[model samples]
Target: MTVSSSTECVIVKYEGRIATVMLNRPAVLNALDEATLKELLYKLKEVAGSAVDVVVLCGNGRGFSAGGDIKSMLSSSDESKFLPIMNTISELVVTLYTMPKLVISAIHGPTAGLGLSLALAADYVIADTSSVIAMNFIGIALIPDGGGHFFLQNRVGTTAAKQIIWEGKRMTADEALKAGVVDEVVAQDFPKAVREKAEAWLQKPIKAMVQTKQILCEGNKQSLLQVLELEKEGQFRMRATADHKEGIAAFLEKRIPVFQGK
Candidate 1:
């Protein structure tokens, strides 16, 4: 079955166990306005509540996103009107980053500012070789928001993250890949790569994958002992699932396991 979300700037389509999320405002390179940001958050929440095993996030047009809408910002003078929208964006970053379902970002064209934040928050990021990537807040006399600092620093280390944000240069896909910003750089056929990756992951034990993701996402903040304890607890829980039994049986039988996400 296939279903599309009724959102203004964001589109969500679910097929089988996979949900594809698209940032759909093509005219401004998918630049997010207040309505768009709220819609994206709502869609993410809906996806999290559903039974989707994996999520693939991408933009609908030539660019992923140009970040927050500058026009909106420029027009608004009252901090009250603006701060709520900014808060929404932050919530969006947190939702995408910590979602139980494994999230993959397919980036192309110009991705910068909060747009890059959204991509980095995902579990995996795949970009086209010709894509322009940046942390571009410096150009606007602003700093990276929407957890951009945390994501960049986590991926590429502190110094590089700082430099990337400070310089605010448009980075080539090769440069971004070398910096460990994105997981894969596809020379061509960006959509094909995303589909292949989503299909591959969907075949595995999804519940186990989500459990592993939870532990790993919290790994940095915890001590080794705490991480080990989580691993132990997680292992204990996973051991009792139906998927685990199927996996063991498949291994003994030398056949593929069919995981039902139980």
Candidate 2:
């Protein structure tokens, strides 16, 4: 079932109507690098065109994803790489949001920033109780990217989304469920429950499910236009701050971020 990638950044498995795309970097807590992001986009694009009735996104080991690869990104001498990489990450989430098939994220551990955006873009999000989900961009003096602002606002509305993203608060799976960020919180029976849900979804007519997905996405599409514009402006402003640089550095140093709120 494993579909090998050219870059070996992502692994895909197909069984019946479901295609499981695994983020394959367990060594670094599945932290996303540029290549991983590109491979994920490519894999999702490929799946969208296939006969796959549903897609399940998950990570291999401890975490869903630790967001971006701070070590790799910060170690690079070039700052010019940031915008393009962030844009591609944004496109990946947008792709997930607009995909025709039913998409679900099975998040077990930490899902932060772009990772949380990816989950929120899905039709349903299934998280384990031990998981931590957060927007987390403000901690780095950056605004939400990877369509985080757009997807989060769609789920939790403007006020809650503002508090979550602006405050960069880490939410428990139960809290995320209450906030509508997670559709289900499965503590002990996650694997079985997720499988049952996916199997149940596959029982219905694929076209009907697809159309329903389209209708839901269409309802939210108009809102993304404004959300994305505001998010881009926020990122532009955040990148200019000294705290942003310090935040990234602090993350790499494994120390607490000291943001002056500048």
Candidate 3:
């Protein structure tokens, strides 16, 4: 069943087989405060296990995200309070990383710190030209967490990833695309552009798409032989799906397939 979360900090909107998870703290550029982070974790878990064909993770307001609330983090001395938020960040990132549903990070505005982490973790990241992105953890004297190391390394090579982290400079959408961070960079009208991309994914065989996402994500840490075994199992699983049969039939008939994600 399609489910949506209506929490204060995060808005989970489900429609047309897509769950759009928007970070709602626009005033501070959707800063990752404790409450917002907790709500995000809850919503991500809710969608991760749901039957939604795709998830579009975006931020509401001027930018995609600013990562953390720098002021609150700098002033706070309470480990009890701060640590839980950090832990929740870990959970949210992991959920996005391992989820079977296809996730697309629709970015606009300034995405920095762990915000970049979250975006990189997604299966597809599409941003408009207005977006500015950076690792920027060095500014706070902190290392990149939230799977930043893993995701960035996966996209760019280790050398480039290390250079990016060390430089800690913001990059334009074009530069990001060159770095292999932003999958597609459109002009203005990001809302429409992003939705169009998601809707296009909706037209394909979603179950197989999700299974492919799983195989690729796990392939990162797995050996070549192990990945081959995974591919064998995955191929078998996809072959048994009704969508697969429909796909084969459609190809044979030279017609478009109507996939129900079965």
Candidate 4:
């Protein structure tokens, strides 16, 4: 049996015990705007409440999500517009991290910034060989958000996480795996690999696995919330910096940014 609950920006499809949630905006590499984020949050909650043992989060088009929408960033010049968006992101990240079901992020193509953060929240991440992963918020003179600080530190330790964030370099799938950013790298038939992995997990004592996840996640949930709060305040301050202005200008102009460190 197949069940689908889809919207303009997010698609939810359930097949037996597996639910697949796909980011649907292909035009801009699925760059998440406020609307898309809200839709995704709704669908995630719906799936969390369902009977699915495994949830596969993926993208519909050529790649997984690129990150937050650049257009939205350009437009949200004030606190009123920006805070709401950040809050939504925080809620969505928390929900995904605390979800009872085993979550897998199947990543392909460019996954950077907030997109990478979201993928890190998953229980396991499977990336295609050609996929590029980055925590490139520094390029925009912005700190990582969406519990990125917590998740990255959890995956790769604090020192390495700080280095990666400061350098803002993109990593190939193998490099990401080496850096402890992703779980598995698929060389061929990426979709088949993800399906087989999911099927294999389904054959296990999934309820016990989920229970263990719940215990650990619940214990650490408060820490993630605290990081999210710090990110919100820090990002707001960064948005007001002169470096941020120059960074956005350089990005739009397709030139190298000269950050003033302001």
Q: Give me the runs in candidate 4 sitting further than 4 Å from their true place.
A: 1-7
Q: In candidate 3, what are the lDDT values of residues 1-262, reduced to their tens digit?
A: 1123334788888896899999987878888887888888898999987878889999887888998776566466564664466566666776887788989999888999888988988889998898899998654334576667777777898899999987889999999999998899998677889889999988999888888878876776344224334433443355457776675566467786686777
Ranking by lDDT: 4, 2, 1, 3
Tens digit per residue, CA lDDT, model 4, 35-151 = 999999999999999999999999867678889998877776666888888899999999999999999999999898988899999999999987889999999899999999999
Clashing pairs in 3: none
Overlapping backbone residue pairs in candidate 4 total 0
Candidate 2, residue 56: how far the Cα is off, in Å = 0.5
Query: How would you encode candidate 2's per-residue C-alpha lDDT over 1-262 as one tens digit per residue?
Result: 1223334667888998899888888778778889899999999999988898889998877778888776787678576776787677767877888888898899988899777877778888999887988888887888887778777777888899899987888889998899898899997877787788899988888788789788877887767656666666677677778899889878778899887867
Which window of ten consecutive residues has the lowest lDDT sum in model 4?
1-10
Clashes of each: 0, 0, 0, 0
Q: Which residue pairs in candidate 1 have backbone atoms (N, alpha carbon, C) closer than 3 angstroms, thus clashing?
A: none
Tens digits of per-residue lDDT for model 1 on 1-262? 1123334688888998999999988878889888899999999999999998899999877889888777665566464665577567767876787799999999999898889988988999999886899987654345577777777877898899889987889989999999999999999777888899999998889789999988887674333224234433443455457776675566467786686777
- What is the TM-score of each predicted model, taking all chains together? 0.80, 0.90, 0.79, 0.96
Whose TM-score is higher: candidate 2's or candidate 3's? 2
By TM-score, who's the top model here? 4
Q: How far is 218's C-alpha from truth in model 2 (Å)?
A: 2.9
> Given candidate 2, what's the lDDT at residue 199?
91
Q: C-alpha displacement of 64 in model 4, angstroms?
A: 0.7
Displacement of residue 143 (Cα, Å) in model 1 is 0.5
